[model samples]
Target: MTIGIEYLRVVRERFAVLKGQGDKTFAQLDEEHFHWTMNDESNSIAILIQHISGNMVSRWTDFLTADGEKPDRNRDGEFKMKRMSKAELLDCWEHGWRVFLNALESLNEHDLVKTVHIRGQAHSVIDAIERQMAHYAAHIGQIMFIGKQIKGEEWANLSIPKGGSDAYLQRMLKEK
Candidate 1:
């Protein structure tokens, strides 16, 4: 498989893990918790989701053909708390990922050489994908870290549980 395709797969899988981790983090929290900001400078989980969803919809729709910044995107509104329900939040998250995955599936090695514009700046398709991957991972890490802090001892580990990594590694090696 081409590196581009592999990167796509990896992003998709990472997205799934991040989504699940975020959801698990929120499962115990109330709507107030979702909207809580540490200060004026901090964005809540709701804001993050909205921003991510907006980016995904704009960047992925007609991905290779159109500029990554869609004319319809409201960049500022994303920071506002729009959806109050967890269901709505999850829906927005899924909507973005579905669009992103569809666009990734449409890509081919030759398409990597094609240039696309984001905020009027030109970038090759592969470069754009890599950039978004890093961006998403960074945000997701923040989300997970905050989730853990908010939940404290009650927070469920998203990956291997504390003290379970050795056993998990042993099991994986045994399977191999």
Candidate 2:
């Protein structure tokens, strides 16, 4: 594969891994846990979902042609506490990822060198993708942290569990 194609493929895989981690974290939490906050100032998983979804839609829709911070996006509103069912929250999450993934899928190797604007600032497509990847990964980390805090001892491991690294390594070797 060309470097650009390889890069796109790897970027999609990385994003899938991050999304999978978020999915595992969500699966471990109850509906009420989505709203749990460490303090009045901190955002809950619900807020994070709203913000991430809003961001994804804004940044990915018309990704190559328009500014990433869309004129219609209410970025601040995404942070406001809103009571939503687990299903609703998941729906929002799915929508965002769908838009993002679809946009990525639509890109060709030639698009990688093209310029895109985010908040009126110029960026190459590669830079734009990397920027959003970091953003989503950070939010997913927050979601996982909150889930782990709420579940405590009951939380299932998303990766190699504690004291299982050796076993995990052996298993990986066997697969190879």
Candidate 3:
């Protein structure tokens, strides 16, 4: 496959994997669990989700023509504590990802080299995408960590469960 197509495929797969990981974690959490945090200064899962959605919208809307950091973005507001229903939170999350993934999926090889501004700084489109991917992955890890913290013994294994490495490795080898 050509370089652009390969990159696109890889990016799409990575995004899907991240989403699946988040989905599994989220399913194991309730509204109370989502709002729990380690301390007053810490971000609850709800806050994190809000922040991610806000960041995604700012960074992905008008991704090529306009600045990634939109003038109207209220980044600080994303972290404020709120009593959002699970459905509302999920809807916002889906909207953000739709905006982001749609922008990403529409790009071609030529678009990869085009200048995209993020807060007035110019970046190649691929670089901007990579930046957002890294940002999202970090937050997803936080979400998983918080989920695991809350569920403790009840937490669903999002990856290879602890002490199951030998079985996991063997299973992978068999698949290969």
Candidate 4:
């Protein structure tokens, strides 16, 4: 594979990491906890998921031919409180990832340098992907944090169990 393809492949794997974290987080909560916020001004886990999915759809749909910000996207409305069941929330999340990850898979080295616009500002395809990746990761972090706060002692470790990093590293080294 060419260098660009290798980078794109790594990008694809990063999205998978997000999916895994999100799935595990979702599994730890019920619909009742999805909408809890620390304050009136703060966003809840549901809002974060909605915003991330909204961003993914806006940036990925028809990504190459048009501006990354779709005219129909209600970016601000993503933060509004909605009575979303866990199923509805998951549907939105999966839809966005499906579009975004599919776009990543379809890219070639030649596409990496091609210009794309986000809200009219131009970015190379690579830059655009990097931007979205960071945005998504930030939201996922919020989701996990909130999950931890709400679930408290019941929250499952998304990575190494609090003190298991040494064991994890040793196991990895042994496997390698």
Clashing pairs in 1: none
Q: Write the per-residue lDDT of candidate 4 for residues 17-82, one digit (tens) a residue.
A: 988898899999999889999999999988988898898889999899999889999999999999
Query: What TM-score would you give candidate 1 relative to the actual structure?
Result: 0.86
lDDT of each: 0.80, 0.96, 0.91, 0.91
Please give, for residues 1-176, the per-residue lDDT of candidate 1 as tens digits.
87867766776687677667767776766666677777889988888888887898999899877889999899999987675687788788889878987887777768888999898899988789888877777777777777776778987777899789999999999999
Q: How many residue pairs clash in each candidate?
A: 0, 0, 0, 0
Candidate 2 lDDT, 1-176, residue by residue in tens: 89999999999999999999999999998999999999999999999999999999999999999999999999999999999999999999999999999999999999999999999999999999999999999999999989999999999989889999999999999999
- Highest lDDT scorer: 2
Off by more than 4 A, model 2: none
Off by over 4 Å in 4: none
Against the hidden reference, what TM-scores do the models get? 0.86, 0.98, 0.97, 0.97
TM-score ranking from best candidate downward: 2, 3, 4, 1
Residue 32, model 2: Cα distance from true site in angstroms: 0.6
Q: Could you give the C-alpha RMSD of every candidate to the true structure, in order shown?
A: 2.2, 0.7, 0.8, 0.9
Candidate that beats the other on TM-score, 2 or 3, i.e. the better one: 2
Clashing pairs in 4: none
lDDT of model 1 at residue 105?
Answer: 76
